[model samples]
Target chain A: MNSRLQAWLLALPATFFVVVCLGLPVLSTLATTFGEPAGPFVTYIQFFTSGFRRAVLLRTIEVAVITTAISLVVGFATAWVVARSPGRIKSILIIAAVFPLLTSVVVRSFAWMVILGKNGIINKALLALGILNEPLSMLYTEGSVIVAMVYLFVPLMILTLVGVLEGIPQDLTDAAASLGAPPSAAFRQVVLPMAVPGLIVGAVLVFTGSFTSYATPQLLGGDRQTMMGTFLYQRAMVTFDWVGASTIAAVMVVVTIATVLLMSRLARKLNPVVG
Target chain B: MKTRIHPALIAFSVFTFVFLIGPLIIIIGTAVSDTTFLTFPPQGFSMRWFANIFEVSAFPRTMVTSFTLAVLATTLSLMVGVPAAYALARFRIELPKFLANVFVLPILVPEIVLGFSLLKSVATGVGASIWTSLLIGHALLVLPYCVRVVGASLNSFDFSVEEAAVSLGCPRWKAFFVVVLPNIRAGVIAAFILAFITSINDVSVSIFLTGPGISTLPIQLLAHMEQFFDPTIAAVSVLLMGVTVAVMTVVEWTLGLTFLTK
Candidate 1:
């Protein structure tokens, strides 16, 4: 066989499997929304027209944005520390940062449930400290979901940022400082601009992660705090609203893809070389 | 001249680490609590919850199912992903771009979407069993990781040894097995571990794909938690974390966790 044919042949099996199993299924399911008798966009219309679903969609975006924003700040600080640390400490810190990722999301969310429950640690501690006469209802709320998601995804943000931060020379900031720029001004002018690409990458990951996350919202937020992921699950599995589910799924994919493309474009504009 | 990291930044990072790792520590602590309800800073110590993991039955059964499913899916992903990675790395072909995207399309799409899609198309449309649909979904889930990790490994490898083997008397295919495979063993192993862990821990896809009598460990735990708020779940979670720690230790020893950065 010619080299082209050989390469194509080599790539064929995985490509074929993915197309048949994943690609076709997702596409066909998206197409199912169009098959609705009322109209091609009826499911989407119904979804948007409903106050609850609109809230869910807005809440999903809100959670994702908040999670991404928080993760970026925390991850940047943590990554900066890890990246600048000496070799042994850097390795240890990276391991520490990544250790949570190795465990299941279910386990991690369960931990939050333990911490936030009425009789859980925080309530007990607050009670013991006389901080509150009554336990605050923390679990099964939007705040709880966001907190759990930040814990779940911040490591990803750190992983994405650390290498890029490490590649930046430390002297660049110092040079700006030595040139009579304030330290904060130096960071804003020198370090922050350069870190934009990594920031975008990390932001995109955390955003989409929390955007489509199922387990955390379902476990911690419950029905009271319905996000897109949990909404899709309820529509599909519980009510068997296939059209509604398909619409949600299609919208989610489109939103996720759009976020990625928009962020990549932003990253490219900011850092042409890396892009 | 050495620059100093700000004390405030150091303090903030310390807080972040505690936030990141604190929950797992709390879970571990709760696991050993003697109380019926999940609690931290135990009132007393007991091994009953660990024993209760066995008595729960779903925990042990689904653990086996999850392990078997993860192994099978990782194997399937490797079989499909290795050659694709090789072709992409070595071929210098234009189609590699399109093919690479297709291979990675699963990761780009929300896994919940993929899971629901598979449930609709494979299970309902094609009439495949839920178990088979799950296997297919999970394999697709991990396939991208397999390709990316192994492809990174392949890119760094010197292909000249395989070329030399081909030039000498060995067939091209045989040369790949004898020369290339041995060299990229670490990557393959790394990919396997990563894929296995991902498949096992997966909840988004598995949640949708699972049906009656065919639940993964995570799904089982999720269901168990919905019904009960007890230390048994904590015990089971601690055990699951143990598995993760063991796998990560192996990765640290062999490839170093830095590979995860890739």
Candidate 2:
């Protein structure tokens, strides 16, 4: 066969898979938004106008931002430690970081329930210490959701940053030190600026992961805080409002894509190498 | 050549590691507990909860369904993704960026959105079964991973040997199967394992695609937890964790952990 024909022939199978399975479905879902009983713009209008949905959207953004910020800070520290460690210790730490990601989200979320439940570990200890008269209601709250999400996603940020941190030569820091720059100053001026790309990439991953995650918010937040994912679920499955659900789903996709673009642009502007 | 990790950083790292793995250790601990209610540090130990998994009829069946689906999805994705990766990597193709992005877009899209979209499409069809929906969904989900890993191997591959074989009157197809496939075999295998794990662990997409009387392992476990709130789910979680750890070990051995970060 001619190489072009051969190439298309080779690519046909996967292209068909994406087109039929993903492209068609996503387009159809977007199409459904226009067919809503109220009107074409009704679902979108209601979504933006409704206080409850606006709150959910804002809460999702808030939780995702906080989770990303916290994950980046903690993950950066973990990655720095792992990157600087000797071989055996490095392997152990890296494995510890990646191992949690191998388990199911349900499994991890359930694990958090055991740890953060009303009569769970922390509460049990607090009660034992006589810090409270009764077990505190920790589970099924926004705080629980954030904690569980950070636990679930921090590993990703760490993995991302570790690669970047490892790529930096030791001489750069040593040069700064020889010039009388303190350890903290070297990190702030030389290391942190160089790590911006990884930071941006990690932030995007953590933010999007936390924002779009359904299982974490569902089980941990319970019915208390309805994030976008949970709200989309209830609207689609429980209420059978596919049109309204599609509207939410489309909005989420747009927001996520926009965030990715924005973050990368910001990264490029901040990092001369990328720009 | 010489450096020391800061003491405070080491402390923080230890805490982070503990925070990441502690919940899982607690889950395993809870699974081994003899008590009915869930507890982190068990009062006593027994294998009853582990054995209790078999008592739940739906659990085993759902597990079988999930395993079958994962296997089928992984196989199908390899079949589709390998050739596509080859074309994208080797062919002097136009619009390569857009085509590659199309293959990878599923991962970029949120699972909740993907699931909802797939559900809408499946709903419009005439009497589609849950299995068909799930298989299609999962295959789409894992296709990107297959392409990615395979594409990476193909990128750094020496194309001269294949061309040399072709110059010696060897057919193109034979060159691919006899030479190209063997070299990229490790990448293909890594992709297969990653895809299988992804398919097995998926709950968000599965939740929407699953129909009456059909559920994946995660969904089944989630439903069971909603009602029971016992150690049985913990037992199941441990078993699932064991399988994942084993799969990840294979991935680490074959492809190395750095392959994922890259």
Candidate 3:
């Protein structure tokens, strides 16, 4: 076979699978949006105007962004410590990092509900310890949703960062330290720059996973959170508003694709790989 | 190894572990409690809940159904995903690299969306039962993992040997079956475990599509936990946790866990 034909034949199955299974389903979802409830324009108008739609859209984005940012910051510190630790401790810590992800999301999120609940351990302990005069309504707040999400994904951040950090040579840090550079200064100058690729990869994972996370926000947020996930379920299954849910789903896809493209463009601009 | 105690770092790591394992411990504690109500540091140790879990009629059937679904899904994923991996590896496919990204991109896509697509696909087109719909949905979800692992191995293998096998009297099927199969066996087993765990633990899509007649383990957990706060959920959680950790350990040892972590 000609190389062109061979290449095509090889790639065709994967391409076909993606198109039929993933791409078409999503497109069909969009089609449902248009085909149902007086077509696309009306659905778009309804989604934009409806209070539930606006609130859920705004809240989902807010929770996702805050979770990603916080996970990145904390994840950096945790990974840095573990990466530099001794062998046995390092493996132990790595296992701990991956532990959160291994547990079922339902189980993990359910655990958060108990811990963050009003009469649950955290609040009850605070009450007995006199930390708070009253049991705070910490359970179903935006803070709880963000906290649960960040907690759900911090291990992902640490594991990803370790991949980046392990690739960095110790000699550079030693060279900087020998040159009279302080520990912090060496990390900033030598370590941080070299680890940017891994950092970008980790950041992309945390961003995308958090952005699309449903159970964490849904189970934790309850009434107040009513995120796009909850809204999507409500519209599609419960309320049968496929048109509105599809609009929301399309919006999410656009946002995800746009952010990834933006980051790739920014990664080229940063040139952190060389620096 | 001469590092002094980094108190702040130690505390942070401990806190993360606590955050990770705290709920599980609490649920386990609750399940053993003597009190009828759900209470932590449960009133007194009792095996009654485990007994109660068995007494429930739907529990046994649900377990069998869930296990069957996961097995079928994993098997189907290996069948379809492995070849696609070989093709992508052996031949230069003239598609946007984005398609590869799209193919493997469904790791944690919001379940509601998958649920919607699945429901739409089944209800409208395939008109299949929930069992078939679930099998298909899960197979699609797990296919990417199989592709990733198989493709990783195939990419690293010596392709010239395979070409030689084909060039000789050996037929294409024999070349692939005899030559390439042995090379990617580790990946195939690893992918099977990963796919099985993923399908078994599946909840998001199950929640949406599960009719009264069908319920995955995770779906059943959601149902019980919603209706009654008891420690049986914890017992079940422990069982589920065991499977996940077992899979993770095997994946780590066999495939090198770093691939997934990275």
Q: Tell me each candidate's TM-score.
A: 0.98, 0.97, 0.92
Q: What's the lDDT for residue B93 in model 2? A: 56
- Model 2: how far residue B2 lies from native, Å: 1.8
CA deviation > 4 Å runs, candidate 3: A1-14, A35-39, A130-134, B1-7, B93-99, B105-111, B164-168
C-alpha lDDT score of every prediction, in listed order: 0.90, 0.89, 0.76
Tell me the tens digit of each residue's lDDT in model 3 across A52-156: 778878888888888888888788878877777888888778777766677788888877777777777788888889999998888789999898888788888
Best by TM-score: 1
Kindly give the stretch of ten consecutive residues in candidate 2 chain B with the minimal lDDT sum: B120-129
lDDT of 2 by residue, B84-157 (tens): 99999888454356888889888889988888887888744535678888998899889999999999989878
**CAPRI-style docking class of model 3 based on DockQ:** acceptable
- lDDT measured at residue B88 in model 3 versus the true structure, 0 to 100: 73
**What tens digits encode model 1's per-residue C-alpha lDDT throughout B132-232?**
99899999999998998899889989988888998898999899999999988888998899899999999999988888888999999999987988999
Q: What are the per-residue Cα lDDT tens digits for candidate 2 across A37-91?
A: 7778888898899999999999999999999999999999999998888878887
Quick one: ranking by DockQ, best first?
A: 1, 2, 3
Query: Top lDDT: which candidate number?
Result: 1
Q: Is candidate 2 or candidate 3 better by DockQ?
A: 2
